[model samples]
Target chain A: MTHTDNGFSATRRLILQGASAVVLVGLGNLPFGLAPAFAAANDKYPEEAFKAKSEADAIKALYGKTPEASDKVKMDAPEIAENGAVVPVSVTTTLPDVTSISFLVAENPVALVASYKIPAGTMPSVANRIKMAKTSNVIVVVEAGGKLYSATKEVKVTVGGCGG
Target chain B: MASTIRVRATSSGETTEVQALIQHPMDSGFVKDAKGEIIPPHFIQQLTFEYDGKPVFTADWGGGVSKDPYVKFAFKGGKKGDELKVSWTDNKGASDTTTAKIQ
Candidate 1:
């Protein structure tokens, strides 16, 4: 378990320079005075989005837009999860110019499980483990070419992950 | 005093696939304890992977993530022996960063 503060100090500039560059898709204008502030806003942890209890509100807060159903998005997950505490889920997309990917559990206390920012040169695919409170649909959203597209699948949980 | 992040980055000539497993409670604040007391929320809020000083992947996570989170992804153009930096910051302001070599 070796660790160091070295990585944090070195990457500080890069994080502050902020890769919210992907979200710059629709800001339209960037004034000199507000440039720094705007960039910071893009990189900051999306507190509100993660706090949203409903799937719709979480997506709106995270992307500020609605997604259309897309066949291009492919999601893989078990039809039944015996342990809701750790459900394996993965999403991959054939959509071009994808900028981000997000996963949401409609029945979880916080609907938004995770949102990933995809920088250029990175593949538009991700795999992660999420908690499910009950039998519910898991939605995966992919933001490609400045538009949002989504796909969902229902996962039956034998045990609730939140211990609810 | 150990790093909570473990990462494996492998390059297959053209693209590098990265898999990371992090240690954290990821408590959603909705769970109860043996005494029926609610466990307060504590979870990693953001995780980033960088190569050549550029961020290739960034994840914004919530309490819904499982304990000791694991994530996998890939990026183009990383060569063997090159370095990849993985770091994470939690809701409580605790963070750790580790450097792994692409194999």
Candidate 2:
């Protein structure tokens, strides 16, 4: 076993060198590693739709008026979210002649999360999970028969979801 | 890969409706871990509903959405005992299909 110990040591050194080279190459390609801590700050949505902190603010931003809750729109969400990263939500409506459906998170950086255009003769319902930065209200706005109806449910986000 | 997708359809005299929620991780590229690495975008990109092998509804999505995406849509001609199949594909090329009988 000791006959070629010199060769074995040389091979071992070469293998270690190659492994370090691979690691260096991998780290060099990671743009996130090179940038300063402040350089990779989180980007905010450009649209003004998300800044609303209250239900009234969100509604005023979306419809130009504070929304009055009606029985027509129904919003469903967990009372206490175990994980704020993804909170499941569903909105259904019994309103007649629904035309559109939209969802908003009152406290998110941008309140307006998603909006769907329901085609004619189609059901006006949407189910989606949204990111909640904190405990906030999830609102659903429905347009039925050319009239807008809304609903809200308070969702408690115990942990941060937006890369906190 | 051949598991049956469960879909429930209900009709309230005037309109036929169906609702479905699939288990998926709709990762938007914007999400980052404690290490500050940008998590590549992974989201449901395609979804389709079929009734007896006939296409009924289709949807396309982007990374602006959240995780575990849920979608609800309705059709006019669904009836009790009809078969509804739903399938989805994520940005990473992973796919899942499920089906349920309309009741």
Candidate 3:
């Protein structure tokens, strides 16, 4: 009888301990749950409103003005991308007095993709891969000698790069 | 951040060729989270190369690509002492640009 009572008490204690641990974890998560609310309170702008519907929109948002289309910017990409996740891209330019380079995706949220400030006496060239949520035009903008020149290329995203 | 970008420039007579590689996750938002929810797409969309205050190349990209996209190209009239600057931007509005000297 004594042994049976001891076993029962030990089991009860174990259950209580488990319950307390669960309560502690729940309390710990409460702060995390409130974090989003705090973030929303601090947000002043509708961040999604800045998303670009096309490559043009992205450029406008980036420089606060329109960029002139120029042949000097060479945008190399596959006409048809087999995979929507990884597309190889290369951009070369022969523009003189180049000071900066940038890239943008037209159909993405907040399209002004990347920018590079070229130091004096450096070669102006860049290559990289970009993800597409869907089929869209890729745009390149170059700030050369204080003037901005741009180019665009249409890329077809057959498979959804963003989960559909 | 503080990642190494490998740059190689080859010269044949007057023409100079350049190649570069950067370490980036190139995360595609279509991936799933641990709970199987589709993660939003994030990717690099633009890149540019400049040599000695001259724009040599520029590229535009989209989602139908893979992670850590590798790029290679050639240009005419690059010298051995030229500076090659590379920069990129992503869909999330994040940007990074780095420079490599032609060797």
* Candidate closest to the true structure, highest DockQ: 1
Instruction: Write the number of the candidate with greater lDDT, choosing between 1 and 2.
Output: 1
Clashes of each: 0, 8, 45
User: Which 10-residue span in candidate 2 chain A carries the lowest summed lDDT?
Assistant: A38-47
Ranking by DockQ: 1, 2, 3
Lowest lDDT sum, 10 consecutive residues, model 2 chain B, at B55-64
lDDT of 2 by residue, A1-164 (tens): 68589889999999999999999987886786654432222111212443454556655654565556898787889999978777888788888877556677777655666655565556666777677777887888887776778888898878967655
What are the TM-scores, per candidate, against the unseen true structure?
0.86, 0.56, 0.53
Model 3 regions more than 4 Å off? A1-57, B1-18, B28-30, B38-66, B69-103
Is candidate 2 or 3 superior in lDDT?
A: 2
- Local distance difference test values of all predictions, in order: 0.92, 0.67, 0.67
DockQ of each: 0.62, 0.21, 0.18
**Candidate 3 residue-wise lDDT, A1-164, digit = tens:** 99999999999999999999999988888878676665344222212323555556655654556779999899888888767566676677888877656767677544655555454444577666666667878878888877889888999988856454
RMSD value for candidate 2: 17.2
Q: Kindly list the per-residue Cα lDDT of model 1 for residues A1-164, writing each as its tens digit.
A: 13456777668767755656534733544455376665466578999998899999999998899999999999999999999999999999999999999999998888999999998899999999999999999999999999999999999999999976
TM-score of chain B of each: 0.98, 0.84, 0.84
